[model samples]
Target chain A: MFRHVVLFTWTEETTDEQKATLAAELAKLPGAIPEIRAFTFGPDAGVNPGNQEFAIVADFDNVEDFLVYRDHPVHQAAIAEHIKPIAASRAAAQFVFQA
Target chain B: MFRHVVLFTWTEETTDEQKATLAAELAKLPGAIPEIRAFTFGPDAGVNPGNQEFAIVADFDNVEDFLVYRDHPVHQAAIAEHIKPIAASRAAAQFVFQA
Candidate 1:
Protein backbone atom coordinates (compact mmCIF):
# COMPACT_ATOMS: atom_id res chain seq x y z
CA MET A 1 0.00 0.00 0.00
CA PHE A 2 1.06 3.59 -0.56
CA ARG A 3 0.54 5.96 2.34
CA HIS A 4 0.02 9.68 1.89
CA VAL A 5 0.61 11.58 5.09
CA VAL A 6 -0.01 15.30 5.44
CA LEU A 7 0.52 17.56 8.44
CA PHE A 8 -0.99 21.00 8.76
CA THR A 9 -0.33 23.99 10.97
CA TRP A 10 -3.35 26.23 11.03
CA THR A 11 -3.02 29.99 10.80
CA GLU A 12 -3.68 31.72 14.10
CA GLU A 13 -6.83 33.28 12.74
CA THR A 14 -8.42 30.01 11.63
CA THR A 15 -11.55 29.26 13.66
CA ASP A 16 -12.93 26.05 15.01
CA GLU A 17 -15.88 26.25 12.65
CA GLN A 18 -13.55 26.42 9.69
CA LYS A 19 -11.67 23.40 10.93
CA ALA A 20 -14.89 21.45 11.47
CA THR A 21 -15.94 22.26 7.94
CA LEU A 22 -12.59 21.09 6.58
CA ALA A 23 -12.89 17.84 8.51
CA ALA A 24 -16.39 17.27 7.25
CA GLU A 25 -15.33 17.91 3.67
CA LEU A 26 -12.36 15.59 4.06
CA ALA A 27 -14.58 12.84 5.45
CA LYS A 28 -16.54 12.90 2.24
CA LEU A 29 -13.60 12.15 -0.05
CA PRO A 30 -13.71 8.37 0.31
CA GLY A 31 -17.28 8.30 -0.94
CA ALA A 32 -16.54 10.89 -3.60
CA ILE A 33 -13.42 9.17 -4.96
CA PRO A 34 -13.03 5.44 -5.43
CA GLU A 35 -9.25 5.54 -5.31
CA ILE A 36 -9.11 6.41 -1.65
CA ARG A 37 -8.97 3.06 0.09
CA ALA A 38 -8.47 4.40 3.62
CA PHE A 39 -8.64 7.82 5.21
CA THR A 40 -8.19 9.18 8.73
CA PHE A 41 -7.87 12.78 9.78
CA GLY A 42 -8.53 15.03 12.78
CA PRO A 43 -7.23 17.82 14.98
CA ASP A 44 -4.02 17.18 16.81
CA ALA A 45 -4.44 15.96 20.37
CA GLY A 46 -1.45 18.17 21.40
CA VAL A 47 0.52 15.50 23.25
CA ASN A 48 3.69 16.85 21.72
CA PRO A 49 4.27 20.58 22.03
CA GLY A 50 5.93 20.65 18.65
CA ASN A 51 3.02 18.94 16.93
CA GLN A 52 1.09 20.51 14.07
CA GLU A 53 -2.58 21.39 14.40
CA PHE A 54 -4.01 18.71 12.11
CA ALA A 55 -3.06 15.56 10.22
CA ILE A 56 -4.26 13.21 7.54
CA VAL A 57 -3.20 9.64 6.81
CA ALA A 58 -4.65 8.18 3.67
CA ASP A 59 -3.92 4.96 1.82
CA PHE A 60 -4.09 4.01 -1.83
CA ASP A 61 -3.08 1.03 -3.95
CA ASN A 62 -0.27 2.96 -5.65
CA VAL A 63 0.92 6.35 -6.89
CA GLU A 64 -1.55 6.34 -9.74
CA ASP A 65 -4.45 5.85 -7.37
CA PHE A 66 -3.13 8.54 -5.08
CA LEU A 67 -2.93 10.95 -8.01
CA VAL A 68 -6.50 10.16 -8.91
CA TYR A 69 -7.57 11.22 -5.45
CA ARG A 70 -5.25 14.20 -5.53
CA ASP A 71 -6.59 15.53 -8.81
CA HIS A 72 -10.22 14.62 -8.19
CA PRO A 73 -12.46 17.68 -8.27
CA VAL A 74 -13.72 17.09 -4.72
CA HIS A 75 -10.19 16.90 -3.38
CA GLN A 76 -9.05 19.97 -5.30
CA ALA A 77 -12.10 21.90 -4.20
CA ALA A 78 -11.38 21.07 -0.59
CA ILE A 79 -7.80 22.26 -0.92
CA ALA A 80 -8.63 25.52 -2.67
CA GLU A 81 -11.79 26.33 -0.75
CA HIS A 82 -11.08 25.08 2.75
CA ILE A 83 -7.49 24.06 3.36
CA LYS A 84 -5.29 26.67 1.73
CA PRO A 85 -6.89 29.80 3.19
CA ILE A 86 -6.63 28.62 6.79
CA ALA A 87 -3.43 26.67 6.69
CA ALA A 88 -0.19 28.39 7.71
CA SER A 89 2.08 25.55 6.70
CA ARG A 90 1.65 22.14 5.14
CA ALA A 91 4.11 19.26 5.15
CA ALA A 92 3.56 15.97 3.44
CA ALA A 93 5.22 12.63 2.72
CA GLN A 94 4.41 9.43 0.87
CA PHE A 95 5.82 5.94 1.44
CA VAL A 96 5.15 2.36 0.44
CA PHE A 97 4.26 0.09 3.34
CA GLN A 98 4.91 -3.60 3.65
CA ALA A 99 2.45 -5.60 5.74
CA MET B 1 -6.16 4.79 20.44
CA PHE B 2 -3.95 7.83 19.98
CA ARG B 3 -1.99 8.28 16.78
CA HIS B 4 1.43 9.91 16.85
CA VAL B 5 2.62 11.18 13.50
CA VAL B 6 6.01 12.74 13.00
CA LEU B 7 7.49 14.12 9.78
CA PHE B 8 11.16 14.78 9.27
CA THR B 9 13.28 16.69 6.78
CA TRP B 10 16.89 15.63 6.66
CA THR B 11 19.74 18.07 6.47
CA GLU B 12 21.50 18.18 3.14
CA GLU B 13 24.47 16.42 4.73
CA THR B 14 22.49 13.40 5.86
CA THR B 15 23.37 10.16 4.09
CA ASP B 16 21.34 7.14 3.06
CA GLU B 17 23.28 4.98 5.51
CA GLN B 18 22.27 7.26 8.39
CA LYS B 19 18.65 7.17 7.30
CA ALA B 20 18.73 3.36 7.14
CA THR B 21 20.11 3.22 10.66
CA LEU B 22 17.34 5.48 11.87
CA ALA B 23 14.70 3.32 10.22
CA ALA B 24 16.21 0.11 11.57
CA GLU B 25 16.31 1.51 15.10
CA LEU B 26 12.77 2.83 14.85
CA ALA B 27 11.51 -0.58 13.71
CA LYS B 28 12.62 -1.99 17.04
CA LEU B 29 10.45 0.30 19.19
CA PRO B 30 7.38 -1.98 19.32
CA GLY B 31 9.41 -4.82 20.81
CA ALA B 32 11.47 -2.59 23.09
CA ILE B 33 8.46 -0.72 24.45
CA PRO B 34 5.30 -2.70 24.94
CA GLU B 35 3.19 0.45 25.18
CA ILE B 36 3.82 1.09 21.51
CA ARG B 37 0.91 -0.86 20.03
CA ALA B 38 1.87 0.04 16.46
CA PHE B 39 4.88 1.64 14.80
CA THR B 40 5.78 2.35 11.20
CA PHE B 41 8.65 4.44 9.85
CA GLY B 42 10.42 4.83 6.53
CA PRO B 43 11.92 7.22 3.99
CA ASP B 44 9.51 9.14 1.82
CA ALA B 45 8.77 7.43 -1.53
CA GLY B 46 9.02 10.88 -3.26
CA VAL B 47 5.91 10.74 -5.40
CA ASN B 48 5.04 14.25 -4.25
CA PRO B 49 7.68 16.82 -5.09
CA GLY B 50 6.98 18.88 -1.99
CA ASN B 51 6.98 15.96 0.48
CA GLN B 52 9.34 15.66 3.37
CA GLU B 53 12.05 13.00 3.47
CA PHE B 54 10.66 10.69 6.14
CA ALA B 55 7.70 9.96 8.38
CA ILE B 56 6.63 7.89 11.37
CA VAL B 57 3.07 6.95 12.30
CA ALA B 58 2.70 5.20 15.61
CA ASP B 59 -0.16 4.27 17.87
CA PHE B 60 -0.65 3.85 21.60
CA ASP B 61 -3.51 3.06 23.93
CA ASN B 62 -3.49 6.63 25.28
CA VAL B 63 -1.36 9.62 26.12
CA GLU B 64 0.22 7.89 29.10
CA ASP B 65 1.23 4.90 27.04
CA PHE B 66 2.50 7.18 24.31
CA LEU B 67 4.63 8.97 26.84
CA VAL B 68 6.02 5.71 28.10
CA TYR B 69 7.30 5.01 24.62
CA ARG B 70 8.43 8.60 24.15
CA ASP B 71 10.52 8.66 27.30
CA HIS B 72 11.80 5.12 27.05
CA PRO B 73 15.57 4.98 27.19
CA VAL B 74 15.77 3.06 23.95
CA HIS B 75 13.62 5.57 22.07
CA GLN B 76 15.49 8.51 23.50
CA ALA B 77 18.73 6.80 22.59
CA ALA B 78 17.58 6.42 19.01
CA ILE B 79 16.54 10.06 18.75
CA ALA B 80 19.65 11.40 20.39
CA GLU B 81 21.98 9.02 18.63
CA HIS B 82 20.45 8.69 15.19
CA ILE B 83 17.71 11.28 14.64
CA LYS B 84 18.67 14.69 16.01
CA PRO B 85 22.02 14.87 14.30
CA ILE B 86 20.73 14.34 10.79
CA ALA B 87 17.26 15.81 11.12
CA ALA B 88 17.01 19.39 9.86
CA SER B 89 13.44 19.88 11.00
CA ARG B 90 10.67 17.80 12.53
CA ALA B 91 6.93 18.32 12.61
CA ALA B 92 4.54 16.14 14.53
CA ALA B 93 0.85 15.68 15.43
CA GLN B 94 -1.25 13.37 17.60
CA PHE B 95 -4.91 12.54 17.38
CA VAL B 96 -7.42 10.05 18.75
CA PHE B 97 -8.57 7.44 16.25
CA GLN B 98 -11.96 5.78 16.53
CA ALA B 99 -10.90 2.57 14.79
Candidate 2:
Protein backbone atom coordinates (compact mmCIF):
# COMPACT_ATOMS: atom_id res chain seq x y z
CA MET A 1 0.00 0.00 0.00
CA PHE A 2 1.02 3.59 -0.52
CA ARG A 3 0.14 6.61 1.51
CA HIS A 4 0.46 10.37 1.64
CA VAL A 5 0.43 12.30 4.84
CA VAL A 6 -0.07 16.05 5.03
CA LEU A 7 0.49 18.47 7.84
CA PHE A 8 -1.10 21.86 7.64
CA THR A 9 -0.75 25.07 9.59
CA TRP A 10 -3.62 27.46 9.68
CA THR A 11 -3.16 31.20 9.87
CA GLU A 12 -3.12 32.75 13.31
CA GLU A 13 -6.24 34.62 12.31
CA THR A 14 -8.11 31.37 11.83
CA THR A 15 -10.79 30.73 14.41
CA ASP A 16 -11.99 27.49 15.94
CA GLU A 17 -15.37 27.84 14.24
CA GLN A 18 -13.77 28.37 10.82
CA LYS A 19 -11.46 25.46 11.41
CA ALA A 20 -14.40 23.29 12.30
CA THR A 21 -16.17 24.33 9.14
CA LEU A 22 -13.14 23.53 7.02
CA ALA A 23 -12.63 20.25 8.79
CA ALA A 24 -16.19 19.36 8.03
CA GLU A 25 -15.68 20.28 4.39
CA LEU A 26 -12.54 18.17 4.17
CA ALA A 27 -14.34 15.25 5.76
CA LYS A 28 -16.49 15.17 2.68
CA LEU A 29 -13.64 14.54 0.23
CA PRO A 30 -13.02 10.88 1.07
CA GLY A 31 -16.33 9.76 -0.39
CA ALA A 32 -15.80 11.97 -3.42
CA ILE A 33 -12.32 10.73 -4.28
CA PRO A 34 -12.36 7.36 -6.03
CA GLU A 35 -8.78 6.26 -5.30
CA ILE A 36 -8.75 6.74 -1.57
CA ARG A 37 -9.01 3.63 0.54
CA ALA A 38 -8.94 5.42 3.86
CA PHE A 39 -8.78 9.05 4.91
CA THR A 40 -8.20 10.49 8.35
CA PHE A 41 -7.96 14.16 9.27
CA GLY A 42 -7.92 15.91 12.63
CA PRO A 43 -6.67 18.93 14.52
CA ASP A 44 -3.25 19.12 16.11
CA ALA A 45 -3.27 19.80 19.81
CA GLY A 46 -0.27 21.88 20.81
CA VAL A 47 -0.01 19.74 23.90
CA ASN A 48 2.92 18.02 22.21
CA PRO A 49 6.06 20.11 21.81
CA GLY A 50 6.13 19.86 18.01
CA ASN A 51 2.41 20.33 17.60
CA GLN A 52 1.09 21.95 14.45
CA GLU A 53 -2.43 22.87 13.30
CA PHE A 54 -3.74 19.79 11.54
CA ALA A 55 -2.63 16.43 10.14
CA ILE A 56 -3.94 14.04 7.51
CA VAL A 57 -3.28 10.41 6.63
CA ALA A 58 -4.70 8.91 3.48
CA ASP A 59 -4.09 5.53 1.91
CA PHE A 60 -4.20 4.14 -1.61
CA ASP A 61 -3.69 0.79 -3.34
CA ASN A 62 -0.35 1.86 -4.85
CA VAL A 63 1.69 4.77 -6.13
CA GLU A 64 -0.57 5.24 -9.12
CA ASP A 65 -3.62 5.42 -6.96
CA PHE A 66 -1.82 7.90 -4.75
CA LEU A 67 -0.84 10.02 -7.72
CA VAL A 68 -4.39 10.03 -8.93
CA TYR A 69 -5.58 11.24 -5.57
CA ARG A 70 -2.82 13.82 -5.43
CA ASP A 71 -3.97 15.48 -8.61
CA HIS A 72 -7.62 14.51 -8.83
CA PRO A 73 -10.03 17.26 -9.80
CA VAL A 74 -12.31 16.41 -6.93
CA HIS A 75 -9.49 16.87 -4.48
CA GLN A 76 -8.38 20.04 -6.23
CA ALA A 77 -11.85 21.44 -5.92
CA ALA A 78 -11.98 20.51 -2.30
CA ILE A 79 -8.68 22.25 -1.70
CA ALA A 80 -9.76 25.35 -3.56
CA GLU A 81 -13.16 25.50 -1.96
CA HIS A 82 -12.22 24.66 1.59
CA ILE A 83 -8.50 24.66 2.33
CA LYS A 84 -7.15 27.61 0.40
CA PRO A 85 -9.07 30.10 2.45
CA ILE A 86 -7.50 29.32 5.81
CA ALA A 87 -4.43 27.12 5.51
CA ALA A 88 -1.19 28.99 6.04
CA SER A 89 1.48 26.43 5.24
CA ARG A 90 1.58 22.73 4.45
CA ALA A 91 4.05 19.87 4.13
CA ALA A 92 3.45 16.48 2.61
CA ALA A 93 5.30 13.18 2.26
CA GLN A 94 4.53 10.18 0.09
CA PHE A 95 5.41 6.60 0.97
CA VAL A 96 4.97 3.30 -0.85
CA PHE A 97 5.57 -0.02 0.86
CA GLN A 98 7.82 -2.59 -0.81
CA ALA A 99 8.37 -6.19 0.17
CA MET B 1 12.81 5.31 4.40
CA PHE B 2 10.63 2.95 6.34
CA ARG B 3 8.54 3.77 9.33
CA HIS B 4 6.36 2.19 11.93
CA VAL B 5 3.67 4.68 12.82
CA VAL B 6 2.00 4.19 16.18
CA LEU B 7 -1.32 5.71 17.16
CA PHE B 8 -2.00 5.64 20.86
CA THR B 9 -5.02 6.31 22.96
CA TRP B 10 -4.48 7.15 26.59
CA THR B 11 -7.01 6.18 29.19
CA GLU B 12 -9.70 8.86 29.50
CA GLU B 13 -8.42 9.70 32.92
CA THR B 14 -4.98 10.48 31.52
CA THR B 15 -4.27 14.09 32.46
CA ASP B 16 -2.56 16.68 30.27
CA GLU B 17 0.43 16.91 32.60
CA GLN B 18 1.02 13.17 32.58
CA LYS B 19 0.58 13.10 28.86
CA ALA B 20 3.19 15.83 28.55
CA THR B 21 5.60 13.87 30.70
CA LEU B 22 5.01 10.76 28.61
CA ALA B 23 5.41 12.73 25.40
CA ALA B 24 8.81 13.87 26.56
CA GLU B 25 9.77 10.30 27.34
CA LEU B 26 8.65 8.88 23.98
CA ALA B 27 10.20 11.90 22.26
CA LYS B 28 13.58 10.82 23.57
CA LEU B 29 13.50 7.37 21.95
CA PRO B 30 14.61 8.63 18.54
CA GLY B 31 18.16 9.46 19.61
CA ALA B 32 18.61 6.23 21.56
CA ILE B 33 17.30 4.02 18.76
CA PRO B 34 20.39 4.77 16.61
CA GLU B 35 18.61 3.77 13.41
CA ILE B 36 15.76 6.20 13.61
CA ARG B 37 16.06 9.23 11.30
CA ALA B 38 13.08 11.32 12.30
CA PHE B 39 10.50 11.28 15.05
CA THR B 40 7.38 13.37 15.44
CA PHE B 41 4.58 13.02 17.96
CA GLY B 42 1.65 15.16 19.05
CA PRO B 43 -1.82 15.12 20.54
CA ASP B 44 -4.85 14.84 18.29
CA ALA B 45 -6.79 18.11 18.60
CA GLY B 46 -9.80 16.10 17.51
CA VAL B 47 -11.25 19.37 16.32
CA ASN B 48 -11.52 17.84 12.88
CA PRO B 49 -13.41 14.97 14.41
CA GLY B 50 -12.41 11.28 14.29
CA ASN B 51 -10.11 12.40 17.05
CA GLN B 52 -7.72 10.17 18.87
CA GLU B 53 -5.27 10.56 21.71
CA PHE B 54 -1.99 10.90 19.84
CA ALA B 55 -0.26 10.21 16.52
CA ILE B 56 3.40 9.51 15.82
CA VAL B 57 5.57 9.45 12.71
CA ALA B 58 9.03 8.01 12.85
CA ASP B 59 11.30 7.34 9.88
CA PHE B 60 14.13 4.84 9.57
CA ASP B 61 16.48 3.80 6.79
CA ASN B 62 14.72 0.51 6.04
CA VAL B 63 12.52 -2.23 7.40
CA GLU B 64 15.34 -3.60 9.52
CA ASP B 65 15.98 -0.24 11.08
CA PHE B 66 12.28 0.01 11.83
CA LEU B 67 12.32 -3.42 13.42
CA VAL B 68 15.40 -2.56 15.41
CA TYR B 69 13.68 0.50 16.86
CA ARG B 70 10.58 -1.50 17.53
CA ASP B 71 12.28 -4.14 19.68
CA HIS B 72 15.32 -2.32 21.02
CA PRO B 73 15.94 -2.25 24.76
CA VAL B 74 15.96 1.53 24.85
CA HIS B 75 12.58 1.66 23.15
CA GLN B 76 11.22 -1.08 25.32
CA ALA B 77 12.41 0.67 28.40
CA ALA B 78 10.85 3.90 27.32
CA ILE B 79 7.58 2.18 26.48
CA ALA B 80 7.47 0.34 29.76
CA GLU B 81 8.50 3.32 31.82
CA HIS B 82 6.50 6.00 30.04
CA ILE B 83 3.89 4.50 27.76
CA LYS B 84 2.65 1.57 29.83
CA PRO B 85 1.81 3.83 32.71
CA ILE B 86 -0.77 5.82 30.78
CA ALA B 87 -1.53 4.51 27.31
CA ALA B 88 -4.86 2.72 27.05
CA SER B 89 -4.98 1.30 23.50
CA ARG B 90 -2.58 1.39 20.58
CA ALA B 91 -2.57 0.67 16.86
CA ALA B 92 0.34 0.77 14.47
CA ALA B 93 1.13 0.45 10.75
CA GLN B 94 4.48 -0.01 9.08
CA PHE B 95 5.38 1.39 5.67
CA VAL B 96 8.39 0.85 3.43
CA PHE B 97 8.63 3.38 0.67
CA GLN B 98 9.51 2.08 -2.80
CA ALA B 99 11.22 3.96 -5.60
* B7-88 per-residue lDDT for model 1 (tens digits): 9999999998998888888888888999988777778997779889999988898989988988999999999999999989
Docking class of 1: high
Position B6, candidate 2: lDDT? 59
DockQ of 1: 0.83
Each candidate structure's TM-score, on Cα atoms with residue i matched to residue i, is: 0.96, 0.52
lDDT, residue A27, candidate 1: 89
lDDT of 2 by residue, B23-59 (tens): 7887678667789887766665333334446767777
Model 2 reaches what TM-score against the true structure? Answer: 0.52
lDDT of 1 by residue, A1-99 (tens): 888899999999999899999999998999999998888898998767878999999889988999999899999999999999999999999888764
Best by lDDT: 1
Reported per model, the fraction of native interface contacts reproduced equals 0.77, 0.00
Question: DockQ of every model listed?
Answer: 0.83, 0.04
Per-residue lDDT of B37 in model 1: 82
